[model samples]
Target chain A: MSLPGCYPLHDAIIAEKLTKYYGDFLAVDHISFQVRKSEIYGFLGPNGAGKTTTVRMLCGLTRISEGKAYIYGYDINRELVAIKKLIGVVQDISNLYMELSCYDNLMFCAEMYGVPRHQRKERVMDLLRFFGLEDKKHVKFKELSKGLKRRLAIAAALVHKPKLLFLDEPTIGLDVKSKRQIWNLICKLNEKGITIFLTTHNIYEAFRLCDRIAIINRGKIIAEGTPTELRKKVSGNKIIELQVSPPIKKSTILDNVDGIIDVNIGRDNTIYITINDAIAALEGILEIVKKLSLEIVMLNLRGADAEDVFIRLIDGTEKNIGSSTRR
Target chain B: MIDMLRLEDIIKAFYIAKKDIKEYYLKPPTISWGIVFPVAFTLAFILKGGHHAQEIIPGLIALALFFGTTSMAAASIVFERKIGSFERLLLFPVSYIGIALGKTLSSFMFGMVSLFATLVVVLPFILNIPTYSLFLVAVLILSALMFSAFGVFISFLIKDPTNTMMIFNSIRLPMIFLCGIFIPISSLPLPLRLIAFLLPLTYSVEATRFAINGNYDVVPPIESILLMLIITILLILLTSIKIRRTIP
Candidate 1:
């Protein structure tokens, strides 16, 4: 399917070869992508993959070493002030003032964003209620539980009702329940017409929440697509595992079988087979086993997921969409 | 839009200052370092002898202001930077000068508070110590502002809290010796006198001495005041530059 326009008119973010270098070391190699309006764009990468570096550049917290980026048509380098007004950032760590209570933290953020005094109280109260932090409004940020602290951090970022929100690992260290609550909050925020740029390493989080995901490795983007689209990158292959009384001594027995991609005989008399058409090849596989007089004990077939694609891309087994490897 | 931006900068700066004052300036450790230590040190001088006790008051006040402003500013900024909150401040729409000014003003106010506490503790005990109130207030304000700027400058230059405190102590302790705080600059050797001339605290102490005694032991009081003002402006400029380059 083709996008409607040459340039995405509804894009909230656009980067043109955005790059960053620390002295001689390149932290973010030239990488470019777009985030559409009102969509949750997930930025996934391994450690030291420049995911945080890219987000920091877009938010104007770090200077770009080369190339340029624009947030809602405002150049990040030249019009940072204008861009800052339209965006809110929740860093990986809770950056709220620990000494201040939850209410004061929100009020302070409101003040920073220049929310009028008359509306500041209402804005803060609304955020407290929205994040379900109203009961802990008077509690100091340091005294709040890890879950509450994360909630208050997100609440603080929303004090100004930013058009775009940059969330860096919002639910990184939260309990399962807390993580689910934040996911719901993120969904609710997006429902109200806010675009979200999220950077996370949690595959499930990205898979469940992001409208689109871009996987980056070693400062370069290796793949960009929806979760299902990425899964399809390796969908041509299927995994079939079989247990037999005696493992086949010659792995070449299935080499000539139609639709069989590869076969690996493992310890404990287990046979692993990769095939193109599992339904068509199942008979051939069983025929070989019967001829060898191997008793079939167990069998299982599995499909690929986002985690598999991620591993393949990062491990250099899958070629990048555009062959972006640098010499 | 420009007017609103300026207004927002001012408001954000105020919020940062308020938060810092509550979080750092009013804390027990800062209060003790700024107030209690200076009072105790000054009292030790008073108890030792009444002959030169009046002369030591200005030095004590200067000492309190120096430690009060520098320690609080350095500790606050280093702590914020270490915990990653300072980077969040950079994401706000405020300019670098606004952030520097906000921190400087809060530290300055804390310095003034410490100066006030020192005076309240010592003034009633001293007799016949002539005080020119106008010049005294001028000297106090200028010294606090200049030292606050110095504190902010040093904080921006160093990242670790321990290293900042060490540098501050090394610079301030040596300055106390060279600035004629405890002894007359004229009585020092020529080489030491040149060193005293290079120190900003020298002018602050001299101007303060003139404010209390109606005469300066070194250069004229007016010259010292003007020099202190010039140094304050320069320090503010240096602080702004450091913040701009180092923050992002």
Candidate 2:
């Protein structure tokens, strides 16, 4: 009854070969992913990659063209009303009522969700404080700063205490400090056992926060795994950077080098290489240096991280893992 | 059934509607549409009437109600759509019918409030008018509800505020002239009479006139009330269907 190494024992969110078409153009072409309860699941994709459309379908804002999604245990189509009651969404854009004050907006949402009058005020205050917008409770939504407005939207989404939460770029357009605050709040909410399904274009955010991520492009999921598994799959466990002189015909030399898979030319004639083992690769590069009498200005080694895997997958050079793989 | 009325969803709809209508009251242009324009039209007609002043009182009241309801519904939906507040409403637990009904009720209440103001403005002139106050109140309330639903139906068909106002004015001008809002139906020619009888306001005008003049016109007054009720029920049904289709 429990998923291994995750909070969502049962699938909190599930999409099976989901496809969406707008008129003739295929916006989403048979993508699928599962999000576990209490796990911060990141959906990473470029703009126009059908991430918003996918989230809308799961939230019941748009009908799926093919396949289906399930929230908690209910089908999105058949049990929409029940599913809607359980899930809450903070959209990329501000969906808060602008004319209303912070308290009024939350109160309106709470009333619509049928939260009892006796506890409504307490719930509003608690959510406001949680998002660090307690001081702006009396301010109109339009008057608040962009960060506070986003915080208000988060509070509005959680007003009903929905078990499943969807956050679509919660930190988009926010300053770095505001972005950190929102991320911290999101982490705290996940800690309280709320299942989070988030979509973002920020690679580092996904790498740092998500337990598992699905990389989508052109509506199809190109890759899916933990950050570590994905990095290891694309190149290896480490990255090696070597700065050398001009006339760098190291392509042939680097190709024959052991423990190295691929190399890319960095700025200032620096050569960055992906390797299976950092120490062995460094030793091989040292041997090549000694034999050729090559002078190395700088040599650095680091792990192959999510950014490496992402570029390779999108660059059309990654190995094929499944029949549905694009490149 | 009353318990159903007291459900949190229904109450929340009313709360939203009340908030929206109150905001409209605060806005100068919206206040003119909901209160000033309707009252102004009624006064213009009252001052223009000679011997037919008594006959025009109920007609002006119906006019006030019609303009008041249509303007508010059209304005509210267009404003919500413009600012993306409607999307927020869709996220709530409330059903589409609750929203339609709530907006309709608020429009109806606002129309009646404006009508009451118009009646007070015209009171000094109609000294000979009989006070069948209770019957008049009931008839006016029914007529207000009927037109409010009609307004909801109209609002859904429009997408732009400017175009909506243009369309509302185009339809309102002819109806104000042809629906016996400013003239007696009996005075109109036969073909126009048949056309006038088809409009919901024609029935409301007749019923309200009877309630005012104590005419007790045998067949027309009773038939008018029944026909208005029928039209209102049909409009509410249509609004419900349209709203349901819009949910996705």
Candidate 3:
């Protein structure tokens, strides 16, 4: 199928109630969203939140149990061949052939993507140079470092000149420097006019990389908006993070505290208390900790950001669904 | 089969096959396994068979091809599955059948080369006979393809490459004993001979015997060749369907 004129105008990805089931368990529940052209759309959620499953369905790696997805208006099920031409996927594992050299690996992808015979070599060399992998071109993939392998994996995906790229945890399991390097590449790729569909649990990554953020948890998109817009949605709210010794029950904090809108047990024995007024909420939290004989290790009062918005949306979604939807 | 014929997809499949050959089967150790194992097996059997060595050549040659094709055709894909490289192929534009066939092509080439290597070592002893190279070549080609497809079908039965290979060897070892690779079907009991006929290797070795020794009593050369083609087609279709289940 010809890919030149397949697009029905803008909107790079349109997923409507896209669902997936692994045997009897539901992995992705009817989640719908749209990714605008040349924009980075992120699915931000914690682990096992159906983010990877959604991305896999969009890339045609996994079958959709229900609902529909259209890539540039091309149906995923019926028009996958044409869709494959317009999209590239970089899975977290960097699943390129490990035994082949970096040059051979890119060359293989170029050939498989049906690049013109004459252009395969030049395109591969260009990618090697672009990714700063020219020196490592002859090195086998297994011999390269994790950061270099990730770069080569991204380079392989871009060899076909795909318009829409699906990055499933692009900076996953990378060191600080490697993660920043990947972040730069992502922005540079977006500047070159490629639409990116990124899924990550990294709050910093989503905050810095995405043009629009969708908060997905428990197989659904609870909230979707720009980073600033998402932050703005919760800006009226305030957060009091309490790092306490001998943590108390979240229910205890919620039950005794007045003016506390919500309480969640966070990682590392900390608690995130959402409130409208930080001063009044802090007094109530301190009283509860003192009564319980708990020592306050640290406390911080801050305005809501994307992470706060994420926790708020997830908390709201969990309460709205409640025990009836719990699996 | 029609879907496998698309020009671009077929070209992509060839490249996939090329990559597999380069990464897995073309290594010095692997090529040595393909070449040396057959020659060594032939020598061991010739010395053991003594006066019967002349008749054992055809069966050993068939055994060489069988081992060569089935081992790699299945191992390569399951290895990729373990290493996660096969996921890349699944995500590519190539059809499921194309990927399966690409694996088969690599194994088929390997089996053909093994057949040639076995023939080179044994050809001197058989040169005294009025051998038909065309018929022998035809039978070897079809058998290699059939054997390769058979391996592809079995690969879908397991996930881990190491376990898949273990199961493959367990099944292959039985087929070797049951097939006429060591014993003549004509000399075996009726039940054993019937089981041999049910196995693809029976026809492979019998047709080989007919081509090399001008003997055609147990099974006709053309019928054996035809059976190999039909079995190959059936297995290729089965393997393609099995490959599709990977997507879900």
Candidate 4:
């Protein structure tokens, strides 16, 4: 059966120019975005980049200073009750009651969300097993390792099966294996059509999990798009680094190198060339070295990634909002 | 509204409170406050005044109730803040009323346990009077709730646990001494009497004194109960408002 449009306007989440000020400082400047149904929208930024502040605004934990945020067609400030009912948040910290057992913690959350008495036990057990925490059901939260604690936090947050899940730096302090597992779980949840709003400084996690990403800096959103789109919009395909035995001296040799857009000289005598094609640029640089009788020590090539776009957006000289903004 | 507080939430609160109370007792200094100080003060004041042991017994009980309840409430806040449980609760569908009720009830329950244990130790030696017993009991429970709410309010206002204790001491110590918990409020000067009235325990201790000594002239039992009820309501209202705004 097709759902009716009259069934209330549900877009999962819409944050319109949401701004938050703490004293005189703007923690979240005028920023706006929307997460459609079943999309894992990644909020990408550096440490003090206001991503957490934006998440806090959407969850209604912090009041918005200027604009409005809505969840499931309900304005956060005006309809907080309805918004809170449909949303689940996994904050950076593990806020589970350390003294309570994992089963008890899940049950506590289920009960608070008003799951029926008979259904609570089944729901609690399902969530525990889903997170691979069934065996540690009776262990106190404090005794659990950091990764286990994060998993338990996720389990407790999902006990009510909310529609829009907000995960703020969910895998920040976890081990590599645990982080990969969490990434898989997040993807699984997204595949089940649960809209995920994630905020993190880990570019690789965002690349792996997010369907689309917004890069925030200082307090404003600088750029936003899918991972593939972001890589395409930012110039350059590969980064070529050349460490020479006797550092080649010349501003003109690099300036004349074709396909190399930017050259960065480091204090350690390593030359970093941002290029359109690594294969073409590497051949050209080698030809110049052969002609000049220059000695080559080490060469490294890496593909452009979100971290590249992020750095260019924040620290780069030129600023270009992606094509999506104009359209 | 009561349904808003889930059985699981209460259970969680209880578990946390139990662990907190254990940690509290395990600390070397808290043992002195829990066992040594109350007993020492009870004996020191009771013996110093000879037949005045009866006069000081009710006050000592009220003092114990205050110390036990407020300490638990403060510890609850410190632990919750440290664990970021307060932020977790704010993210949930639960209302501020639910959080406040859970916290208040948990601290009050733990406090009563401490008070009961202290009473058991002190009861066999006291005068064992039954004057205005219901009124005294009512005041004890009411003052405990009010002070616990106050502790929670103060907890949200400060960032550090040590700071919470410092602030609690600045506010609670004066109330203990001047609120007729250790002496008669009537004997206090006019300025101090106003300060005593600001404390919920003053009316509590006054009623307890009346219950124990049959001295119900200056303040009636009904008047004391009314005062406590009004103060308790206002404190809860103010605390709820404060806690709601302090969520961030």
For all candidates listed, what's the TM-score of chain B alone?
0.90, 0.88, 0.90, 0.82
* Residue A319 alpha-carbon offset, candidate 1, angstroms: 11
Q: Assess every candidate by TM-score.
A: 0.91, 0.86, 0.88, 0.88
Which digits, one per residue and each the tens of the lDDT, describe model 1 over residues B1-248?
Answer: 11222565666777887878866775666777667877777778776757777787777677778888877787678778878788877877787767777777878888888888788877876675657878889898999988888888888888666676678778888887888778889999999999999888888888888788677788888898899888887776677678768734
Worst 10-residue lDDT window, candidate 3 chain B: B26-35
Per-residue lDDT tens digits for candidate 4, residues A45-112, read 99998998898888888889999777877778777766777888999988888777899888777867
What is each model's TM-score for chain A? Answer: 0.87, 0.87, 0.82, 0.87
lDDT of 2 by residue, B106-193 (tens): 7887787777788788888786655577777788888999988888888877767668778877877787777776666778888988
Residue-level lDDT for B33 in candidate 3: 50
Residue B156 displacement (Å), model 2: 1.8
Q: Could you tell which candidate, 1 or 3, scores higher by TM-score?
A: 1
DockQ of each: 0.67, 0.43, 0.71, 0.45
lDDT of 2 by residue, A161-249 (tens): 99988999889999999899898888998999999888998888888888898888888898899887777666544666677754365
**What overall lDDT, based on C-alpha atoms, would model 3 receive against the true structure?**
0.82
Quantify all predictions' global Cα lDDT against the true fold: 0.81, 0.77, 0.82, 0.74
Question: What TM-score would you report for chain A in candidate 1?
Answer: 0.87
| lDDT digits (tens) for residues B109-145 of candidate 4 | 7567667866776666577656767766776788677
Greater TM-score among 3 and 4 belongs to 3
For model 2 chain B, the run of ten residues with the poorest summed lDDT: B1-10
DockQ winner: 3
What residue pairs clash in candidate 3, if any at all?
none
Model 2, position B169: C-alpha lDDT score: 76
